[model samples]
Target: MSTLQDSGEKPSIYLHRLQVALSVTIKRGGISPEKADQHLLKQFCRGCWDNSLIADLQLEQKKMNPPSFAELLLLLRTEEDKCTAKATRMKQHLGASKQRVLSHSQRAWMSSESEPDVETTETTPSQEQRKSSSAISQPRTTTSKTQRGKPKPWYCFTCGEDGHIASACDNEPNSVLVTTKRKQLKEKQRLWESQNPSADQSPHMAFIQTNGL
Candidate 1:
C-alpha cells in the first residue's frame, strides 16, 4: 500500500525497495510453490510502485519545463565562448596599456637626456699650407757623429792593427751591442736546431761530452 507520493518514504527510496522486490520474485520462481506465489505478489507490487513513481516524476518535470539535453549543451558552449572572448579582449587591453606606458617612459627619459647638435665645416686648405702642415708632422731624422771625427777603421777577419782593421774603434764598448744582437742570433739558432736535430746537440749532452774529453 506504499504509494509513490507517500510522505514517509522518498520516491527514490521507494523505487529501490521495488527493484529489490522484483529481484526476489525472479529468484523465488525456481523454489517452492508457496514462495513463488508470494514472490509473484511482490513483483506486481513493485511494478505498480515503479509506474506510479515514474508518472509522478513526469508530472513534476512538465510543471518545471526543464531544458532538453541538446539545449543545455548549447548553452554551456555559448557561455564558454563568451568567457574566452572576454579573456582575450582583457589581455589585449592590458598589452596595449603596457606598451603605451613603456613608450611614454622612454620618451620622458629621452627628453631629459637630450643632447645638443654640433656643427662642422667642409672647406679645404691650400696645397702649400697642406705641405707645410705635413712637413711639421713628419718625424725628425737622427745624424751620426762620423763627419766631426776621423773615420773609424773597420775590423776584418784576416788582419787586425791600429788605424787599419780593429784598433781605430777600440775605444767603443762592443759588449752592449753584442748583448742587443743576441736576440736575433738566438732565434736563428733555435730555428736551425729545429730543422737539424743532430747538428747542435743539447747543452747537457755538450757538457757531458766536453767533460769526458
Candidate 2:
C-alpha cells in the first residue's frame, strides 16, 4: 500500500533499499544522473517497472525545471572521458616506475651472481720476490755441492796406483826428486846406446843388411 505523507514517512530501511535498487538499475541502463528525470521518471528506467515512488516524484516535479535530459547526458559523457584519460595516464606512469625499479633490482642480482664474494689469499711483491730468489739459488747450491763431492784419482805408489811412480809414496810431494831421477835415467840411456851401437838391431834388421845391402 502507498504510505501517507502524514504517516511520518517510509521506514529508513525501505528507503535505503529503494535507493540501492534505483542506483543499480540506473548504472545497468547506462543512464547518467544528468538524463534522469528526477520528477517524471520515478520508476527505474530501462523498462524496469516500479511505482513505489510515483507520489514522491510528483511532489518533486512541482519544485523545479531541469535541463533537457539528452543534452545533459552528453555533457556527463564528456566529463567521464576526461576522467578516463586521466586514469590511463596515471596507470602508465605507475607501470613505467615499476619497470624501472625491477630493472635496477635485476641488474644488481646479476652482478652479485656473476662476481661472487669469495675470499682469496693475497701475496705481496716482497713475498713473491723472495720466492723467486730462493728458486734461482737452489740450482747453484746443488751444483756447488756436486763439484765438492767429485772423487779425485787414487795414486798410491805401494799398490801401483793410477799414474803413480815409485817416488809418489803415500801421496807425498816428490816433484824435485822425480825430475832428478828422470834426468839420470836419460843420461844412462845415452851412455848405453854409445857402448852398444848394434845392440838395438832386430833379426829383421840383420836380414835386411845381409841380403839387400
Candidate 3:
C-alpha cells in the first residue's frame, strides 16, 4: 500500500480514493441484484482493490470490457469532434463578419475621399471699367430745368409770382397764402407774443381755457 505522504503525491489522491469507495458502494447496492453482480465483476477487472491502483486499474478493467469501453469512448470522441467543429465554424463566421464590416467602412471612407468639394468663385470687373460705365450712364438722367444751370425764382404765395417765398414777402396776405400755412401761423403767433410782454398764462390754464373747461 503506497501512502500519499510516502509517494509524495498530492492530497487529491485521498479524494480520489474516497470517490472510488463511494462509487463501489453505490454500484453494489443502488441497482438490482443482477446489476450488482455485474458491477462487482466490473470492479474486479478494474483492479480497484486500493486507492493507489484505482486510475490504472480502472483503465485496465475498461479494456477488458472491450465492447462497452469502445462504445463509450467513441461517443465521447464524437462529441468532442462535434464541439471542435462547431467552435471552428463560429470563429470563421466571426472573422467573415468582421471582414465585411471593415470592407464597408473602407468603402465609405473611399467614397468620401473621392467626392469633389464644391467652391464658389467670385470675379469682379476692374475698377477703371466700373468708373467709366458709371460716368457714361450719369448724363442720360433728366435734370429739372431750374436745377440745370439756372437760378430758381422764389414764388410769392399771395400773387402766385416767382420773386420771393411767403416768409420774406412784404404783403401780409401773401404770407397767409403760403403752402405751409401751419408754419406761417406759428411764426405770426411768435411775433405777436414777442411784441406783447403782458401775456401771463400757464400752459395748463391755457389748455383748460381753450377747451372751455
| Candidate 1, residue 9: how far the Cα is off, in Å | 36
Superposed by TM-score, candidate 2 places the C-alpha of residue 91 at a distance from the truth, in angstroms, of 0.8
Can you write out model 2's per-residue Cα lDDT over 94-136, one digit (the tens) per residue? Answer: 4433433433332221222222112123443377765775676
The lDDT ranking, best first, is 3, 2, 1
Write the candidate numbers in order of decreasing TM-score: 2, 3, 1
Clashing pairs in 1: none
Q: Global CA lDDT of candidate 2, please?
A: 0.36
Report the lDDT tens digits of candidate 1 across residue range 29-76. Answer: 644433433443343344333343334334233323443322322333
- Candidate 3 lDDT (Cα, 0 to 1): 0.36
Best by TM-score: 2
> Candidate 1 regions off by >4 Å?
1-63, 96-213
Give Cα-based local distance difference scores for all models: 0.34, 0.36, 0.36
Error of 3 at 1 (Å): 29
Candidate 2 versus the native: TM-score? 0.19
Error of 2 at 20 (Å): 19
